[model samples]
Target: MAQVKLSAAGERFFGTNVTPRSFEQWIAFLRLELKKTQRKRITASHNLHSIYLRHNNPDMAEFYARADDCFIDGMPVRRLFELFSSNAGFNHRFTLMDNLPQFLMAAQREKWRIYYLGSTEHVAQKSLERIRREYPNLDMHLHHGYIKDNAAVVDNINKHSPDILLLGMGMPLQERWLLENFEQLEFGWVVQAGATLDYFTGEQAKPPRWLSAAGLGWLYRLAHDPRRLARRYLFEPWWLIAPIYRHWRLQRQENGTPRT
Candidate 1:
């Protein structure tokens, strides 16, 4: 297996062991996999921890292995890549807010069944309606994001058998929920999409594409919700960045050396 060495929060996360393999590699992998398989799958990782290792949070560590395909989802990972090699730091692939919509559109074109599980009945129903309005041919079933009893949710999943399930609970919870119940899900994929409704329903807006590409998506997100996210951006990586930056520099040295 190919791997690229990465250091974060005094911990290390390896990459695909090839240069320039950014977020696109992930999307490419998913697009091809979805084309071939129909099995329970999840695409998730710790955003503040895995992606932003310098800004890592210990609480999120449990979700690492549980993530089917854990993407180091922050600019910190990207920055590490750029520092060590000639690769583009950011891949700008899928984020929960935007990715679900793109995938749903693709599902629509393919005439796939999509089940959305999150929010109240009214909320879930409204999301379904919004999606229908956006893509006329889209086939969507409302399992209702409301969870009075999870067994009932499991039953709906058994009955509809969705091609993809966009799970909308926040992090760790969503990931944990999928791990706990994937055995019973008849879906081909279980994507952990947090707060997708807020953005998808026009309740929030993403930044310009160029800004996202420049690893500025967090900046946009922070600008939108400063009170909620400022501390995360400011204090999360309080002490680890210096050492992490040094390790990242070491990667550059290793990459620059000529092999015998």
Candidate 2:
């Protein structure tokens, strides 16, 4: 397969390179990539947890560094990019939940095969059922994330040979799985789809438009599952302070400005 060339230029945030693409541009990029036969490509998204992981976890850092394309999925990340990046264009947060429907519709039209791997078996079943009802013509496949044999799962995926692979096994796990088996995977695009299936299945409540637009979606998620997210939302960000400060100083130096 010929390499599909696409321009996704951007500045580095902390240690991760992020492409500040608008929702439309992101969709367009995906469409173009899907149209071509190319080597395995993985799309990664960033948020506070991901940023923190990049700083602390070597495996996570390597995954981000090797990602084919990265986007801002968190409002805080988008805000930081606006503060740090000098180049100006649309810098929107591209969450899978917000964009999955449109992309799936496009997949339907294009006859692209999609394989989603994540969520509980129940949630996965529900999501598949919903997709069947809504998009009967769309070629979609699903497998729950709890797998005993990684190789067998890889074999199953290869058998399907999907055009797009939606991996939603959650942070480091999803990232780690791809990093480990990237060479074995046969797909045009591997999307980091964290918790998107849950949202799609209505297992998790979707935040209101105003809250998501106002950048308080984290707060809403925290309110819903405080025990699971308290540390991530409240304490993990504190760990990022030192790295963010160092990045700020480096940015200042690069721009020939005195560090305040």
Candidate 3:
């Protein structure tokens, strides 16, 4: 079946977004593409408050929107997709906490090697230690994140040539880094996982399981760090949510559904 697509204010998302199926399909596609890959990539949609993000951070939002494939990772987006599909359940639904494990499992099963990039050397070190603790058999060669000079980072990445590269640095910078440098790297797939290392290394906590499952992960995050997140959740919707609501409503009207 064709994926139901929604384009809201110049951004796009699927109608039935399942994390695992999307990821697994990504792997299958990447495996094929990587065989001919002079440069191929994968990126996740950690958060794009859509219009707000674009208006406020046009550079980052544009770069992210341009990725070869962008998976919607959070519950808000997943549910946004689920709105159009009945079964809506696909096996691989994991956050970065879950994504890394899936990747590790894939590496173990297929013997694919990974390179860890981004974050401080200390965070990188601690991340490797923790992953080893969790998945003892997984193989990873680590590199410290985005060397100040792009040329050198590309050179080193080309040399290592791992199967997958996980980037922990935040958006636009990370996306730009990959877009500019991915041509030189040998990795089959590159995933941008914002603050993924921090979460893995116990530096940050994900929303509690209940909150996440209930699609209140944003609420949980807002509760945990209101000082930082509140501004985003509040003022951002004026630019982001408002536009999406208009689009979703337009979608409903186009479908001839009764207005709520």
Best by lDDT: 2
RMSD of 2: 3.9
Looking at model 3, the pairs that clash are 15-81, 20-92, 118-145
**Candidate 1 ranges with C-alpha deviation above 4 Å:** 1-28, 35-38, 49-62, 84-92, 120-122, 143-146, 239-260
Best model per TM-score: 2
Badly placed stretches (over 4 Å) of model 3 are: 1-39, 46-56, 84-93, 132-137, 249-260
Error of 3 at 132 (Å): 4.2
Candidate 3 lDDT tens digits, 1-260: 33432222112442211233355665565555556735555655544353355545656555655655555566665555556332345322346654566767667666676777787788888877877787787778666674777676677777877777877776556766776665567776787776778766766656766776676777877877799778778777566666567657765776732121
List lDDT for all candidates, in order.
Answer: 0.59, 0.82, 0.61
Judge candidate 3 at residue 226 and give its lDDT. Answer: 90
Worst 10 residues of 1 by lDDT: 7-16
User: Model 3 TM-score?
Assistant: 0.74
Give one digit per residue, the lDDT tens place, for model 2 in 12-98.
666666787766677768878777767588788888999998877888989888887888888898888777876655476768887
Would you list the rank order by lDDT, best first?
Answer: 2, 3, 1
TM-score of candidate 1 against the unseen true structure: 0.71
lDDT over C-alpha atoms for residue 7 of model 3: 24
Tell me the TM-score of each prediction against the true structure: 0.71, 0.92, 0.74
